[model samples]
Target chain A: MIEDRPLIYKYLRHDKKFPHVWCGGCGIGILLGSLIRAIDHLGYTKDEVVLVSGIGCSGRLPVYVDFNTLHTTHGRALTFATGVKLAKPELKVIIIMGDGDATAIGGNHFIHAARRNLDLTAIIVNNNIYGMTGGQYSPTTPYGQRATTAVYGSVEHSFNIAQLAVCAGAVFAARGTVYHVRQLDGLIEKALLKNGFSVVEVISQCHTHYGRLNKLGNQIDMMKQQRDSAVPVEKARKMSPEEMEGKFEIGILVDREAPNYLEQYNKVRQKAKNALSLQLTKEEKEESERREALDKQ
Target chain B: MHRRKKPEPKAQLMQGNEACAEGALIAGCRFFAGYPITPASEIAEHLSYRLPQVDGTFIQMEDEIASMGAVIGGSLAGVKSMTATSGPGFSLMQENLGFACMAEVPCVVVNVMRGGPSTGLPTNPSQGDVMQARWGTHGDHPIIVLSPSSVMECFTLTVKAFNYSEKYRTPVIFLMDEVVAHMREKVVLPEPNEVTVIDRVKPSVPPEWYLPYEDTSFGVPPMGIFGEGYRYHVTGLVHDIRGFPTLRQDEIEPFLLRLFRKISIHFADIQLVESFHTEDADLVIVAYGCTFRSAHRAMVEARARGLKVGLLKLITIWPFPRRVVEPLTRAKKTLLVPEMNMGQISREVKRVNQGMTTVLTVNKIDGTMITPQEILEKIEEEKK
Candidate 1:
């Protein structure tokens, strides 16, 4: 079903490290496809790009990509990506994380990375449940969803990831579901092209654990649910909050230019250089004057 | 040859942390990630200002866990990287520290110690983390820990820590007590050309043939930095030569054994200790970090009183320096250990002495340095 599949295959490490661990009927493959297409569209060479991932199902995506990939500790993809971007700002750094990996254990790093406006594109796959660890409830699990950790059904509220990103001062924030392949690809490309901290939350499905435990039909039914529940931000803005209760808003929620951390840091470097040079000139002038005084004596 | 600005050779008054930061820069560290904690904050602050000037990157991570994670990432991206913290922050870094060991990622961690089981004291000197530096990370893997007795040693040992980490492909801990961290002393830093620097050995094989963790003649595989054309997997899972996770008994055993042997075989070069006046002595003071200063003074006074005494100052604390300590166990001499904590390294001393000599511990845990007079009194009382 993938058009230009041969072109996309060039971006994958299929020969050595393929047969990825994602389950069949899982939406991670579709979301990962969109991300690959986005990078491909941006014309970034494999050597010029780095994909950093944390632990979980989505975190395994970088393992299959043909870039300078880093598989880091759980809930720490953003921190690692920050280091890569700061160390070599010319490289295109992208981070892949899961719902639990991004907003739960790694929530502090997520918000701070956004607050600093680091030049990174973070894609958090929101499968609602922690799929890798036996379908436990995560921060993005809906209040009434059933998980292994929430057998009777969770009473805790789920986070609105896109809104959270905007609140954390991300220059670009967008949401797309795996069912909306074309739209998700477009959103990822825009996020990547942005020059500051960007987050694109892709609502994906884990039919094996999340669907079976919740008795949500099959994988196709889960995909249908995603398609039916997503409302464009433009339409959601015209509607009331109650109308958006059970649905999520897709499309960019925040897109604005702001000075990224590295750019500001470069300015600091320049200022320090100027100050040091000025001090050196003053010292040199005084030294020359002292030499003249010595000659006169 | 292109012209380069030469740094002037001069002795300047510098704090221990500042010297450490300078040492890291001289050792080719281009990235530093750390969370600010007392007794270790100056290292981060100095790096934050100096790293930028040197075109290096410095990041204050959200916490110590992320700090260590970032250091690993930066190191993998072909930069010498490090982080600094005190006791409470060190506790948070144990897991990632284990990841670095398991993945065989070379990085340096500077723990400027303060009193703590948990946040016990922030701005006080404590040698309490000596044991934690060795066993804090949950694993049986070997680690390198270097303790510096003075500001100059802090700089020299930090460079040594980086060299050992790069040479062995393991994490090295630069263990500094708060007394040494904050105390200012005149330090003559070696010019860049004067000091020895070791870089990670790069793979000679092509990208297609490179194995990230291949066992070679020296047991250390040549590491290829990311984006340098060699791409390979790295994980905390016990992996084989190719750096991919494995569960086979044969693969796991060889991989694990190689990691242990690489350091154990080099024990002669790894273990660094200084012996002072121990020949023909009935008493020897076993000390490390800041406590050694007091122990040295006590040994001088004890000898002045005509009691046979000496000091064995541990410059390298880990791999336990067994070769040096093993001989002391049979010398029929009293091993007096004075520490800032109740007794941490003393336990190791007693274990190594194995009842051959009386291992007496003079420990203080009141957020204060163990005075030389206190060590002298303990030696007198023991003699009586």
Candidate 2:
């Protein structure tokens, strides 16, 4: 049981807004709890943080938190969070998005934000289907999985979000599952502390939609499946791609130190200031000499 | 208390787009997000260099949609933010533009008008987006759009756009055509003391009691920026004064009505139109943006030939300036509207005229400016 429940309660808006819209046996509540614990462990106050979310079931997470939150249009959380981070570089900006919200309509912004290496953390909750819209297939829905839109089973391939983030130039990329709360909390904290674009994709269970459609059993069975299917990166490195077909590799995929966009932007500002100051000093010297000459006359 | 003396106004020969960028800087705009588009690209280019000089942030977004979203985010974070785009890019910005209206986020969007339904002409002048700027975004929402006629006006109007956006808590569109955007003219920018800058009203109440969308008598609630200690929610949904999503009719109706009433109630302050030689003229030419330049010339030429003609140049196109247009139509004379598009704004002229006067349209849509000669010929033909 959480002995520091008071500390966690300080970070939540549990007034009449209690009992959030997340379904019973939903993994989103667990993920949100882990995020709160991570931020609490990092010692970041509510005033120093901002939570931005796009439109989806997971996107509703920000409205329940006690931070400066923005619930924006679907798939645009990263874009809006980028602006918030750039505008106030001192604040810790975090984005919560669903699988469809991140990789489908918002895919362009995802790649570009990663490529720019802006200082922001994106936490993608991947339930493999559009949970808010009733069991529709999403970009992350595994091929051959049954969704409402894929009644005959999905013909399209799924995206490996952690791998996609790594290839897209994200400075920090990792995978975590809701079943492993402690590890997921650590991954989220590490991603938030990274100086550049970071993504922690948590494979959540949508027992209401994705699980029911795919006949993946109840919430407890789904949690057990996730725990069994997730292979840590160190262990997975010993196996071949063929051996890791149905299992997802957990742990950090990419963690590298690179100059973030804000650092480079600061250099640009310094250069412009130096150039402007040089021009101003030259003008000032000329004006002083002219004034001295006028006095001599 | 010692006050720093204001710097004197400096005369500079600058392009309209550059002037618009400079005006944004003067208006306390510290953040800019935009994609490169022809005619309007200079605004982004200029700001990319100028913003950093002022310790402001400038980002070249991936597309116009993200640019608009970033601008909204920046505004929510307590910085005056802006984005510039041409017609095609402006079309891409409509969805978020509506979000800004519905959420009551204050920001400026500069649409340097180019010929387009879709990339019709990138580098050509067109008033084609006048109607798009008004009604392009889905649903009925209040919007303020100010079109600049000259390079000097581009500078002044851009500042006005930011002021109006902050004052009204809504997005203000700076609609410029390619003619004014690219044209170079000697502009005497106002001294710092001469200019009146408006900042968004912030909440005077304590942080715990703050409501982001609190319904006030003036229809505009004080906006609190992120990290300012007022942690309030903001959503695109139809929300109550607390900024939370609600479907209750009473809460939703008041919220929606206030969005419209804030602009409509202040029509006197928001509506701006410049009338030239329409005092005793039987022929009144209605035009805006670059076409107004040609209309002014044609009005003078027609008057010289013993024709009673005048020009009604629209500076504030949205909210339509019906008070100014209604009286002119009551005279029962011919009203000619010429534009670079095939009768977009002319339809508005006709609609406002309500058959009180003969509304004739002289349209040119082949990526060319409507020439003074063409408008003058139309005036002569209408007289016959």
Top candidate on DockQ is 2
As a whole number from 0 to 100, the lDDT of residue A162 in candidate 2 is 86
lDDT of prediction 1? 0.89
lDDT of each residue in B254-283, candidate 1, tens digit only: 998999999999999899999999888888
Clashing pairs in 1: none
- Write candidate 1's Cα lDDT for A32-118 as tens digits: 789888888889888878888899998778777778888888898888788777777888989999999999999999999999998
Give the Å shift of residue B12 in candidate 2.
Answer: 2.3
* C-alpha DockQ of every model: 0.42, 0.55
User: Per-residue alpha-carbon lDDT of model 2 for B167-213, expressed as tens digits?
Assistant: 99999999999999999999898877778899999998999888889
> Estimated TM-score per prediction?
0.95, 0.96
Fnat of each candidate: 0.44, 0.67
Show how many residue pairs clash in every candidate, following the order shown. Answer: 0, 0
RMSD of each: 3.2, 3.0
- Report lDDT (CA) for all predictions: 0.89, 0.90
